[model samples]
Target: MHDPKKLEEGFGDLANEQQLVKEQDHTRNFDGDEKEDSRIGTNQPMEQNQDEQSRQQQTTAVTSKPKNKRIATLDAFRGLTVVLMILVDDAGLAYPRIDHSPWNGCTLADFVMPFFLFIVGVAIALALKRIPKVDAAVRKIILRTLKLFFWGLVLQGGYSHAPSNLSYGVDMKFIRWCGILQRIALVYMIVALIETFTTKLRPTTISPGFFSIFPAYKWQWLGGFISFLIYMVTIFTLYVPDWSFVEHHSDGSKRYTVKCGMRGHFGPACNAVGYVDRQVWGVNHLYSQPVWSRLKACTYSSPATGPLREDAPTWCRAPFEPEGLLSSISAILSGTIGIHYGHILIHFKGHTERLKHWVSMGLGLIILAIILHLTDAIPINKQLYSFSYVCFTAGAAGIVFSGFYILIDIWGLRKPFLFLEWIGMNAMLVFVMAAQGIFAAFINGWYYEDPDNNLVNWILQHVFIDVWKSERVGTLLYVIFAEIVFWAVVSGILHKLRIYWKL
Candidate 1:
C-alpha cells in the first residue's frame, strides 16, 4: 500500500537510463570505426606515392647517367693527336722521319691536319645531332667559322715571330690567309652544313645488313664524291702557265722565274694547286717558307734542311701555300669519311657492333689507298692534299680511334692515358698555349740578360742540352718533358677546375 504514483515514476526513470546507455555505446563504436577508416584511406595513398617516387628516381638515374658520362675514348684519341702535334713540331728538326715530307709521300707529321679535320667531322655529327631549326644551325656554324678564322689569322698569320724572334707584328698587305685552323674552319663549315641539311633524311630506326649504313648517309657521300671529282678534274685538267715570284734576301730583292707551260704537273712550281694559289691569293700573300725548299733538288743537304744548292730550281724560293684553295677542296672527303664513322657511333649501341663497323670501314679505306697508291693512280702527297693521302690517314685514324675505344671505354684502361685525356678535354687551349708558341712567346717576354737569354732557352740549354750533351737527344727529351708533360699538367689542372676553353 505505498503510493502507486511513486512506483510509476521509478519505472519511467529506469527506462530512460537504459536508453541513455545504449546511445553512449553506439556513439563510441561509430567514432572508433570512422577514425580507423580515415587512417587506412590516408596511409594507402601515401605508401603508393612513395613507391612511385622511388621508381621515378631510379629511372632518372639509369637514363641520365649515360648522357652525363664523357666519351673517354674520343677524348683519348684527340689527346693523342695533340701529343703527336707537339712532338712533331718540337722534335721534327732533329728527326726527319717524323717531320712533314718535302713534297710527295707521307710522314708522321702529315697526318695531323687530316686527323684534326676528321675529328672536326666527328664533333659536328655529335653536336648537331638534334638541330631544332635550320637557320639556327647556319648561324651557329657561321659564328664558329668566323671565330676560328680570326684566331687562325692571329696565331699563324705571321703576326708573332715567336720562340726565335721576340718581335711581333705583320704587314697587312703581305698577311698570309690560309693555315691549319683556316682549313679546319672551311671543312667544318661545309661538313656541318651538309649534315645540318640532311638531318631530316636520317632514318628513325637503323636496319640490319652489311651495307645498310651507307644508304642512310648517301647524301653526305654524294657531297664528298662531288668534291673529290672536282678536285681530281681541276688538278689533272687545269692548264698552268709560266709563273714568277720575287725573293727578298738580306742582300737585296731578286726576281725569279719558274718555267712552266704545262698541265697535270705535280712539281713544286708547275702544279695547278700552286698556280691557283699564286693567281688568286697573290705571291706575296702566300706562305713564304714552302716545304719545297727542303727537296734534294733545291737544297745542298738532302734530308736535313740547309743552304740552297747552286743549281737549285727556280721554284725553290717561290711562295707556295700548302693549305691552298684547291687542296682544301679535296680535304672535304676526309671530313665526310669521318662523318660516316660518327654515324656508326650514333646508331650502334653494342661495343662489338661499333668495333666491327669501324674496323671494317677502316680496312676498306686502307685497301683502297693501297690500290691507288701502289698503282700510282694517285700519289700520297700531303702538300697537295691528294686523295690517297686522305684515305690512308683517315683509315689510320679510324683504326686508332677504335683501339682507344677498346682500351678506355671497354677495357677500362684509362689511367695510363689520363694525361692525354686531360689534354684532349682542353685541346684548343693546349693548341694555343703549347703548339702555337704563345706560351713560349709569353715566357720569352720575361728574360734575364736579353731576349736571347730567356727561360725557355735556359731550360733547353741547361736542363736539357747541357745535361744530355747531344743536340738531337736533348731536343727530343726537352720537347717530351717541357712541352708535352708541362702542357699535360696544365690541362689536368684545368680539367680538375672545370676550366675548358672551347671554340
Candidate 2:
C-alpha cells in the first residue's frame, strides 16, 4: 500500500542535487600541457578517438534500471520465512519426523529464524537508507533500538512469573535469564547501532549525475562471512585443550560435570562448558515451559524406578547451561548470516523486474547452502547456532524467499499463499502471542486440557490435532494449520479494525 521507494526519493530530493555530489576525479592522473587538451593540429586522426571515449563515459554515466523489477518479491520473502518458522516450530509434537532443532546437528528447520532476523536487518537498512545522521535522528535511532531491546527482553522473560506487573521489590533470582525475546531484543539493538553508524542499505557506486551504486554494497552475505569467521574461531578456540579458560577449573583433570546436581550423577566430561550446557539443557529449564523429566516413564516406561544417566531429573540451572553468553555468540552469528542473504535480494534492486534474476538468487542460495554443508565449517545446529548452521539455514531461507517472490511478484499471483501473507504481515504479534504462552494458555483453557490433567495428551485429543492417530507428522501439521488459520482470521480482523500493533 505504501510506495516506499517514492517516499525515499522525495525525501532525498530535499537537498540540492549539486550538494549531493562531489567534484569527482574522472581519471587517476592526466598531465595537460595543452597537449592533453587539444592535440588536434598534431594528430588529426585522434579526433574520432577522443569523441568515442567521451561517448563511452557518457554511456557509463547514464544509468539504467535492471532488466527485471519487483519490490513485492521482498514482501513474499518476508512472508515465506514467517510461514516456515510456524511450520517447523508447531511440528514439535512429531519428533524425529520434524524434530530438527535440537542442538549439535542441523536440519531444514533452523533456517527460518536466522532468515527472519536477516530480513529484519535488511528492512532496517532500507528504512534508514535516505536519512542523514542528524544528531536528533541519531539519538532517536539509539533510543528506539534500546527500547526494542528492553521490550524484547521483557517479552522473553514474561511467562516465568504469574503476576502481570513487575514491582521494585521483585527478587532478581525469580527473573528468568535470557530467552528468545531477550536475544531478539539484544541483537536488534546491536544491529541497529551497527546499521545506524555504518549506513546499512546504502550503496557505493556513483553514477555521475545519477544517484545509484552497486547493490551488493547492501549488508548481507559479506556480514555473514565476517560473523561466521568470528564464531568459528570462538568454537574452535572453546574446544582447544589449552584454551584461556581451561585453567579456570579446579583440578588438572579434564573430568567435568556433564550434568549438575548436588547429589545426582555429576562427573567429569570432556569439556567443562559442555557439562554446564547438558545440565541446563532441559525444556523446563526454560521459563514457564516446565522441565518435562520422566516423560518416557510417564508414557511408556516404569514410573521412575531409577534415573537414566542421559535424561535424568535435575535442576535446570545445571552446570551445563547452553544459552550462556559464549553459546549465544553463535546464535547471533546465525542471525547475521541471514541478514547477508537478505542483502542478496536487496542488492538486486534494479534487476528484480527480471524473472530470471529472482530465480537465480533463490537457486543460488540453495547451492551455496549445499557447499557450506559439505564443508561442515558452518554446522547447522540450532542450539549451538554454529557457523555452518547459519550458512546453510540462511541459504535455504534465501531460496524460499526467492521462490515466493517469483510466484507472487514475478507472476503477480497473490492469493495462493494468502495464509502465509496474513501471518507474515503480523509476524511480531504472532511471535509474541505464541512465545508468551497466550496461545498455549488459550488452548489449555479451551481446546486443550486443564492444568491438573496430562498436558500434551489432552492437547492431542481435543484440538485440531485429533485428526491424527498420534502426535506425529499429521498431528504437527494439524496444529500448524489451525494456528495459521487463527492468525489469518486475526490479521483480517485487524485489517477491518484498521489497527496495526506497530512496535
Candidate 3:
C-alpha cells in the first residue's frame, strides 16, 4: 500500500512549504534587527535581551513540522459530512430527523450541506498560501467554479417533461437554475476571492510583552462581519415583499391574491424567500417533494384523499429549496466562518490557545444566534437561510471541528477514523456520484430483486424488517449499512491506489 503521506502531497506540501518560508522570513527579520541593534551600540543588557528574543523566535519558528502538517481531523470531518449527505439525500424522507425541517427550524440533514461549504472555505484558505501567483490561482478558481456550476446543472437541471414531446429541453419553465452544487460553487467563488485578497494565513512573531487577540486572518473576520450585516439587513428589509397570491372562489371566479408580510408569511409560497424563488424560477423549477405536507397528512385518517394538509397555504404546492438563491448569501457567511477556523489552525501554536479560540468562536456564534432568535430579528429558518440559522449551524460546526481536532490531532487518536480520511479525500466524487444516481445505478445492476423488489429491500425484509415487524426501522438500518459499504469500498480502493478526484 502507498503511504498516506504520498497521497496527501497536494495539501501537505502547501502547509510544509509555507512553514519553511515563514521560518526563513522570521529569521531574516530577527537577524536584521540584531545587526541594527549592534550598530546602534545599545546597552549590554539590551543586547543580551535581543539575542534571547532571537533565540526564542528561532525555536518557535522551527517548531513548525507537526503544527503545519495536514490536519487529519479536518479530512475526517469532511468525510463524515460527505457520508451523511449521501445518506440523507439517498433515503432521508423515511425519517423526519434526517430530513430538512419543514420551514423554520433545522434538522441533522441541514447541517451536511453547510458543513461541505465550510470545508471548502477551509480548503481554499489553506490552498491560497501555496499558490502565490495571482493569475494562475484565479484561473484555477474560475475554472473550478465553472465546472462545479456546470456539473450541478447537468445533474439536477433536466426538464420535467419527458422526451416523448418536443418541448423538453427547449422549455425554460421546467429548468431548475439553483441547486446544491450550484450554491456551493457560488459560495466558494465569493469566499475564495475574499480570502485571496484580504486574508493572510502565515504565523506572525508576537512582540515581547504583547499578547495578540487577532489571528493572522483578522481581515477575513472583518469581511465575514460585513457579510453578516448585509445578510441581516436584507433579511429584515428586502425580504418582506408585498406580493399577493390569487385566490379562487368556489364559483371559479378569481380574486387578486392576498398580500402578506413577514409576520403572517410562513411556508413555501407565502414566505419572502419562497416568493423570490417563485418570481425568479417559477413553481415548476423548485423542488417538488413536499415532505412536510405528507407528514401532516399521515397524522390524519386519509393517506391519499384530498391534498395533504400543506404546511404552506393553498397557493403553493412546490417546495422551495433551502439552497435557493436568496439564502446563498448566508451560505457564504457560513463558509467565511470555516475560513476563520483554518486561520486559527495555522496561526495558533499552543494546543490550549487553539482550543480556547475554537471554543470561543463556537460560543460567540451560538450566543449571537440566541440573541437573534429571541429578538425575532431573523428566525432560525433553513428555508430563508436566516441569520440565526447560519450562526447556529456555523457555531455547531466549529464546536464539532474543535472536538475532532482535539481527539485526533492533540491526543493522536487518529487511526480509528482513517477510513473517513479516504472518503474525505475523494468527497466530491462520492457526493456527485451518489447525487447523480451513479452509485444506485451500479448497485442495482448487480444486486438481486427479491421479495421486496430490490436487493437492499430484499435483504432488509428477510434479515431485519420481516423479523422485527417494523419496515421503517429495518429499512433505515439497511440503507445506512448499504451506504457505508458502498462508500467504504470505493474510498478504500481509491485510498489503496492513491487515486483522488480533484477539480
Candidate 4:
C-alpha cells in the first residue's frame, strides 16, 4: 500500500485533461462535414460551411415572418351583403321599406343584388391575380359557372318549396330559367373570362401619375363601356310590339294583352328587357311574380304587395324577369367598377393611399349617379339595372368595403366582426343552406302533426310570434334569430373545423 491513492488520483487527472482537449477541438470545428479525419476528427470546406449556415439563417428568418392572409374586409363586406339578403328575403314582407322597390327607385333590398355583383367583381380581381395557364383557368371558371347555373336551377327554378310545401320537383315545361343565381353565374363567367384574358398588363407597368386612376385596367373598363353602349342602344332602338300572356289565378286562366309598339320605353309594362327575355327564354320560363306587381299602378297598395287594382294595366300580371338579358349587360359595368377597386388593393401598399383612392372613386360615382338620376337622364331602377342604379350601388359598395377595411384590417378590430368574417368565408354554403331555404325545407319535413304544423311553423307560432304578440316584430326577430344568428353560428363552427363549401 505504498502510495496507491496518489497513483489513482494521477490517472483521474489525466482522463479529465483528455476530455477537455476533445471538447475544445469539437467546438472549434462545429461546422464540420460528415466525413471524419484521423488528425482533426472532422473538417469541412469553408465555402460549403458558410453556405449551409446562410441557408439555416434564411430559413429561420422566413419562419419568423408572418404569412400573408386574405383581406378580412372583403369577407366582412360579403357577409354584410348576405345578412341583408336574408333580412330582406325572410322579413321583407313584414317591413316593406326594407323590401325591394316596386319600380324606378331603390330600397334597402334593391342594393343587395348590386352589392353581390360588386363583390363578385372585386373577388375576381383578387382570385385571377396570376392565371398562368389560360386553358386551365377557363376550365375551372366554366366548371364553377356550370355549378352555379345548376344550383340556380335547383333552388330558384321551382324545384324546392320550403315552409309552404314539402314537395320537391320541377316542371321542365314551365320551369323558370332566369334568377339571382343564374344572373350571378353569367356575370361571373363574363368578368372572370375578361380578367383571365387581360392578365398580361402588370400594375407596375402603368405609371401612377397617369391620368386614369385605373391605368392597368383600361381594357376592362373599355369592355364595360362597350357593354353599356350595347345595352343603351338596344334598349332604345329595339322595337317592343304588343305582347300577350295568360294569367292563372285560383279562379281560372285569364288572357291579358299589353299595348305597346314602342322603340324606347322603360315602364314596368313595355320594355326591351322584358321583350328580349320573352323572345329568348319564352314567357313560361320567366319569373311568374315580378317586382312590378308591387307598383301602385299595378296593385291597390303602393310599395306593399296587394291585390291588383281595379284599373290595373294589362302588363300587371305579365311575367317579367328582373334579371333579364338587356339589364344584365348593364350589370357587367357594376362588376367592372368593382374590379377597378380591387386593382387598387393589389397595386397600392400604403393604407392611406388605398383609402384616399377608394373614397375619391366612391364620391365621384355617387356624384355622377345623383346628376344622372336627378336630371331624369337615367332613373335609378333595379329592374332595368339602369346606369344610375349601377353607379349609386357600386359607389355605396366601395364605401362600405373601405369602411370595413378601416375597422377590421387597419385598426385590428377583427375580433368584434369574427362572426361576419366566418359567414363571409363560407358565404356560398350559407347562400345555399340559409338564404336558399334548403336547410329550412329539410327541417320542415320533420313534423309532429299535419304538414302545416311543421317544425318551422311551430317555432314561429309558439316561440317567436306568441312570445312577442306582434306579427311584424315577431317575424323580424324570428328571421334575425332563426336565420342570421343561426347561420352565423353554423358558419363559425365550419370555419373552426376548416370545412369550407366552395363552388
TM-score of each: 0.87, 0.62, 0.75, 0.87
- Model 4, stretches more than 4 Å misplaced? 1-66
In model 3, the worst 10-residue window by lDDT is 6-15
Error of 2 at 55 (Å): 42
Report, for every candidate in turn, its global Cα lDDT versus the true structure.
0.79, 0.45, 0.63, 0.78
What would the TM-score be for candidate 3 when compared with the true structure? 0.75
- The clash count of every prediction, one per candidate, is 0, 26, 2, 0
Off by over 4 Å in 2: 1-70, 134-137, 161-171, 204-226, 239-256, 259-324, 327-378, 442-460, 463-474
**For candidate 4, lDDT tens digit of each residue in 259-374?**
99998787888888889999999998888888888888888776888999989888888888888888888898988888788788877788998888888888889889989989
Better of 1 and 3 by lDDT: 1
Tens-digit lDDT string for candidate 1 (102-157): 98888899999888877767766655665556676677678778888888888888
Model 3 lDDT tens row, 1-503: 11233222122121122332343344554667546544444334444446766755655554332533667787788888877876776566456566676656677887887787777666665555443444545565677678888867766676422211223352465577787778888887887776655524544553332136354456766777776776666545554554543333487844334345563344445565666676777756766544444334232422211354534344344345666776786688888888777766666678887788778889988899888877876677777777788888889888988888888998999888876777777776777666455555444445444322555445667986787788777767766676665676787798677666755
What candidate 1 gets wrong by more than 4 Å, as runs, is 1-66
